[model samples]
Target chain A: MKKVKIYVTLRESVLDPQGSAVMGALHTMGYNEVADVRIGKYLELQVDDSERALDVIVKEMCEKLLTNTVIEDYRYDVEEAVSK
Target chain B: MKKVKIYVTLRESVLDPQGSAVMGALHTMGYNEVADVRIGKYLELQVDDSERALDVIVKEMCEKLLTNTVIEDYRYDVEEAVSK
Candidate 1:
């Protein structure tokens, strides 16, 4: 099996309220050295080995549903899943 | 400055409904090759140089807020933030 790890984040130009909230919380907790925070989504997929390439399948999945192309950017890492 | 990338995921035994829902959707969309789906949280933090080590600060943040250590696992990657 193959494991695909995807990371999706809001575009830099967009405001991230959740991130800001966390940053504020950190500051309040006395971690004043924090400069910024951005929160995003991480997804892991286990897929059966297919005749087609895994990258192609993953990219298609990301473009179709994993990310909103207009406002978010996504990147992925794929690795061989270890046998149990 | 330092950039820290954090990945947080539910422990292996935990049930992930959102992940299952996404897997179901992918199957319905004809991506039958997908076997399992797991979703998690990704966080990016930009931190200023501090008297304490970045790892210490990051671990404190993760343990206190970034992760729910009871049922979740977290790992992080740190790098120097590029100057604009």
Candidate 2:
């Protein structure tokens, strides 16, 4: 199996109100050194080995289901899965 | 400045319903090669230089705000921030 780690984040141009809220909370809690905060999604997929290229599969998955391409951008890393 | 990337994921013992839902959707969409899915949170913090240790600040933030330590675990990477 292959282990795929995907990160989906808001585009730089978009405003992240959620992030702002967290930053405010951090400041209120005395973490004044925090300048900014941005929140995103992280996904891990266990993909069974297949004839199809893993990159292509991952890209398709990101575009079709994992991400909202209009406002979000996604990137992934594929690695060999070690059995537990 | 320092760029801190934090990944917050559910502990192994917790059930991830959201991930299961995504996996089911992928199967419905014909991406059967995807065997499992796990979803988590990614946070990026732009931290200003300070006398306090970065690792110490990050750990405290994770425990107090960024993560729910009972069911979630968090890890982070700290890097020099590149001005854009």
Candidate 3:
């Protein structure tokens, strides 16, 4: 099996109100050293070996379901899965 | 400045309904090769230089604000911030 780790983040130009709210909370809690915060989604997928290339399949999944391309950008890493 | 990347994930025993929903959607969209899905939060923090050790600061932040220790586990990586 192959394991894919995908990170979907807001585009640089997009406003991240959620991130801002967290940063504010952090500051209020006395973590004044924190200058900024950006929040994003992290997804891990376990895929059974298939005829199609892993990268191709992952890109299609990201485009179709995992990411909102209009305001978010996604990138992924593929690795061999280790049996537990 | 230092850049801290934090990943907060559900504990192994916890149920992840959102992940299951996404996996179901993928299967409906014909990506049956995907066997499992797990979702988490990825957070990036920019921190100004401080008197405390970076790792110590990060760990405290994770435990106090970035994560819910009861049902979630968190890990972090710290690196020097790259000026843009």
Candidate 4:
């Protein structure tokens, strides 16, 4: 089995309203030290069978669905693990 | 100004229940190809002042609050930008 992680964020040039809301919430909670904030999403994926051809298949999936390559920057690594 | 990002995941030795639910949700949403999934929290923080000492102050914030450091693995970067 293999695992993939995807991190998604608005393009650097885009504004992040969600992040701002979070920062505001934190401030109201007494964490007034916080300033401009940007929010992003994190996702993890597990693959069923990579028996022999893992690299190619995973990369294709990442390109086609796991990520919006144009705006998100992601780093993924595959590690062998005992069956879940 | 500077920004901080914190990524928190269940320690490798612990089981992630929320993540499992999300995986199930995805499967039901027609992403049957998805398998074991893990979920984590992402946080973004903005700083107010760092007139001359940015690194030192930022590290203190990250260690004392922005992250739980005990159970989370975080990577943060600071870049200069026009004040917001």
Best candidate (score: DockQ): 2
Q: Looking at model 2, how many pairs of residues clash? A: 0
Q: Mind giving the per-residue lDDT tens digits that candidate 2 earns over A17-72?
A: 99999999999999999999999999999999889888998999899999999999
- Candidate 4 has an lDDT of 0.63
Off by over 4 Å in 3: none
Each candidate's interface RMSD (Å, one decimal) is 0.7, 0.4, 0.6, 3.7
Q: Which stretches of candidate 1 lie over 4 Å from their true place?
A: none
Q: In each prediction, how many residue pairs overlap at the backbone (N, C-alpha, C within less than 3 A)?
A: 0, 0, 0, 1
Task: Kindly report which residue pairs in candidate 2 clash with one another.
Answer: none
Task: Estimate, for each residue in B1-84, the C-alpha lDDT of model 4 and write its tens digit.
Answer: 555665656567667787787667666655565677876655556676635366665566556655566765556666554564
As a whole number from 0 to 100, the lDDT of residue A21 in candidate 3 is 98
Across A1-84, the per-residue lDDT of candidate 4 in tens digits comes to 566665656677777787777666667655565666766666667766634466665566556665577876555666655564
Tell me how each candidate scores on DockQ against the true complex: 0.90, 0.93, 0.91, 0.38
What is the Å distance of residue A56 in model 2 from its true position? 0.7
Query: Can you write out model 1's per-residue Cα lDDT over B1-84, one digit (the tens) per residue?
Result: 999999999999999999999999999988999999999999999999989988999999999988999889999999999978
Model 4: CA > 4 A from native = A48-53, A82-84, B1-3, B8-34, B48-84
Superposed by TM-score, candidate 4 places the C-alpha of residue A18 at a distance from the truth, in angstroms, of 0.8
TM-score of chain A of 3: 0.97
Docking class of 4: acceptable
